[model samples]
Target chain A: MKKLLTLTAVGAMLAAPTFADTLRLGAATAQTGGLAPYDAPVMEGIHIAIDEINAAGGIGGTTKIELIEKDVRSDAAQTSIAVQELVDTGVSALILPCDADPSLAAIGIVSSAEIPAISTCASSPTLPMIGGDYMFANFPGDNVQATVSAAWAQEQGHDTAYIIYSPDSQYTTMPLYFAEVFEKMGGKVLGQDTHSIGQQDFSAIATRIAALPEQPDVIMTSSYEPDFPSMLKALRSAGVTSQMIGSDGIDSPTTFSLGDAGEGVVFTTAGYAEEGSPLEAFNKKYMDATGSESQTVFNAVGYDLIKVIEAAVLAADGSTDPKALRDAIANLENVQGATSAITYKGTDGMPVRQVSLIRVKDAGREFLGSPSPDAALIPAPRMQ
Target chain B: MDIFLQQTVNALALGGTYALLALGLAVVFSIMGLINFAHGELMTIAGYVLMYCGIAGLSFVIAVPLALLASVVAAVLMERIAFRPVRNGSGATMLVTSFAVAMILQVLFQNLISTRSQPVLLPAMLSDSVHIMGMVIGVNKLAAIIATVVMLVFLDWFMKHQKTGIAMRAAAEDFAVARLMGIRANTVIAGAFALSGLLAGVAAVLWVSQRASVDPLMGFMPVLKAFIAAILGGLGSLRGAVAGGFLLGFIEIYLSAFLPPEMQEFREPIGLGIVVLVLLFRPNGLIPSATLKAEKV
Candidate 1:
């Protein structure tokens, strides 16, 4: 009778599916090129989150989360290949960068593979709609920040604004989206100028701003590091001096190079480096682990996504099954991350997070209060 | 009126910078018949050196000379290691040699430094603009025009009067004949590379000053535009190079400024199209190389 009972136990164990005790997360992001500076911090944040999760007994103490990373090098073609490799290697979930164009290149593959994927920082509002149910935006869409900044501008009584943007993906699209929102709020878009990345002269553009029929109340630009400081310096030198505003592209600490010019520069971001915020402990831990301070706001994207995945993995009951994990992610709500309060709302998986507005003072960034754009009080007229 | 005047400043500043780059290309082409495709890399190196010095907290005054010196050394070494060995090679071979040099430097820099851009801070005065004649011009650009004019004058004088410069011009006329006529091939070729490198260094500072960022590929567009200008003015004709540089600059700046907002995206295509049309009409370029015919034998 004992032998028969032992045989039945072995048969039951064999009949059930067996899986690895370790849960794997794959990060396919640009490790080099224009995306490197932003993505590097993101990867560090991911590892940091994983270490914290692992230290806390790692999702129910039975399964430890492990990460495998692939450097896409900012090439869209390579992104697809990287995605396949990660999927084949058996990652339960994937983390991606915030750019919509390149993210789209591989998002489809992750969907077809039927694994849950999250973009840490991509802001194109349309990203969530196009990416399948499993595709989630870890950071809130561009419209959220645009609305907040536009509302802030209106509160400051700046009714007319000028825009200068570069042709790069986020820099081009995001600011123009800001223009659309600003105009919808009954603000005048005085003029718009566009320059390619690394353009040598902003004088013509700068001059165009200076010569406007009436100087604008603000010069809002969608520009990033290396270029942002330079462009700001040029505008300051051109003596326009109207309040300068921007999106997260101007969120880097390196803007300190602008000296006095960077002062009074206002921008909106998902993350800011303040001493006693909720993220202080996480920030210190990241600095302790990485041996350097974070550089850009996108750092939160990586950290937040990992946190999201942790919750999802736990909810899915340590299942490495892609469909199960994806459903868990879609169900996430009101999860606090190092960056913001993240909630994947409704069926679209469009994350809703409170946007933080920041301004540069004394060559440093100061966090302004989180001003939520009212959804019901007034609809920002959509401008084409 | 203010807009037009502002764009005019933009045009002159661009034209002046382009002229310097074209002149650099012209000097080497005149002597070597090789395109010296790596000339732009010299510019990149200068910007890198400037960026390094800026990070070290060195004053711009001290950094500028060091950056130029670095560019000159790089240019000389490039000729020694890359160009001299293949001096007698065919045009196709030499062209490939320049490309190989450019690639090697580009890759080396990319690996050693971040492939991403490194911001270089300039003196605060550079970004300051002065109001003059109803136009606000960035002071750095005004200085660029003045500096380019000075450099151009110095280059012209050196070419016409200096013995080494005369030898360079002679070699351009006929490399083998000049070598036989007691014009040292080594000195003339080295001098051409040195002179070209110096101009590239100056142009690099002016070019980088406006953008305030340096990257491995920073030189690509500037050099490509300079190359186009060199070809537009007759590849080896120094005078033609300057004219073509200014012409191309004016075309690009004005097109961007005046093209309707919707059509502005087509500016680059329009500028390139103009170049193509000019090439079609002037097959040898607006100013072809001055051919030195042998005495009727």
Candidate 2:
């Protein structure tokens, strides 16, 4: 009787649609907090991709994609809870917000569950090293951006530089990588300083730069948005006439508030154009649906992640199994994205891509250089 | 010689900002036995007020007092609406209530504006620096030092001779006794919040001036620094708060200025040494209270 019952169950399973199940993606990001502005766009991007796939008769012809989101509120403890709940509900993969704070909080739990996860904007090159094989960062690797930033600075005839780095690893890594690249290219690092994140007063740091015996040709930094403007204003107001260069951290409208203080500041960040590519169409769709302008490059990254995931799933021959998806995503190469062409190196498992060189001029961002294929690639780590 | 002079100005400006914020927090704690964690939100509201005024193209001189008035009004309302109801509650309850108010204000600000820090345009003249004695000092920084010193002196005089001020001091020392002595708790608390708000507004201008931006959580760091100073100076001691604030800022700025490039990252750890020093030799804080000094500060 037991054999007959098992045979009957198998028969019923066979009668259902072949390879049919909802491909569940868990998003553990802040819904309300400092990171919400970043998180909302990524979630929308994922939804946009899922809707596109599902509209065309779903993945594998019958399986639809469902998103499970828990508002971690940028809280670490809440992130753990959200991760546990998402795993218990059986999500195939997990996605994190762009910034490092809360997203790094959730990646560990997902790794332990043997589930695959990708970060939208956490740029630490060291993430994949510690994140196990199950985790990947979708944003351009920090090392890649730093190298390009150095090359761009050199191209602009900057032979000497000073740096003020953010205290956090995710932020300071850019300046760190830039230092590596700078020294490699025979540039002198006149001076370097580190400031704690959220430090509003840059007068002391500014005075240090001002008091230098000979001002460097360029001043570089790795700080994001709010801190970026404060640091720039202080340095500029302190009579340090040296030009400034920085990472994507300086790509904030807030930097423009200080008028001439922000003038001539150069930086590197993600890019997207809406002229001739599918990104243009997608941008229109996104704006129409969300009723809000895209806040930063993370919006494009969010849109790109969904497309990349779709490609990876297809590369796995339409399998939503975590191990299969993880392998496929790790090996994803030359996946055309809205921001740029993204390719994950099999050696380190981080996406390598190009960034736009932007110059700050009178409260506006003007493109200084276009994407360079040679400059954008992340150099593989050498075995010492 | 020039470098030394410039760094001194840097330290002085930084200290003045810290001292003002510390005094703001200390004012409420001294009178009400409340830490007033939501004190920072007063600054945030003020920034928003200035931002809207700037949007209306109001001159910087006109915006300053308007921002101050808005901050004071917000702080008074906070005391009336949030604190007055929980005025007699346990310490933990009052703290939690303050946190709740802070969270509410934060969310409201976020919904009304973007979570991202919005730029606050100041008068271009604010950025102008005066180079005297071969060193440049930002005008805003110079103004900050003057404002802080003036406010502290005025506060000292008011605390020493004014009727409401003495009642506040009496309430801080012994609330029950002060009430028995015909002091109305309501008037004293409102007055304390008003003064606290005014100081926070001054600190806000200094902060917004430096950052050129404002966001809902912009007040967070200033408030934290203020709390640290208040504790380091001796909780509930106004003079101690001022002394601790300046000392904290000086240590932080000088460490950054003097530390070698290789060791500059240790700036924060070195600055935090004040907390250790306080905990060790002077747990009551580095300065004695006004009452202990036998002279009103």
Listed in order, each prediction's TM-score against the native is 0.89, 0.91
Which lDDT value does model 2 have at B64?
92
Cα deviation in Å at residue A268, candidate 2?
Answer: 0.9
Best TM-score goes to which candidate? 2
Backbone clash pairs for candidate 2 read: none
Candidate 2 Cα deviation (angstroms), residue A248: 1.7
Q: Write the per-residue lDDT of candidate 2 for residues B230-264, one digit (tens) a residue.
A: 87887778888998888888888888888887788
Worst window of 10 by summed lDDT in candidate 1 chain A = A375-384
Would you give the TM-score of chain B in model 2? 0.95
Q: What RMSD, rounded to one decimal, does every model reach?
A: 5.8, 4.5
The candidate scoring highest on DockQ is 2
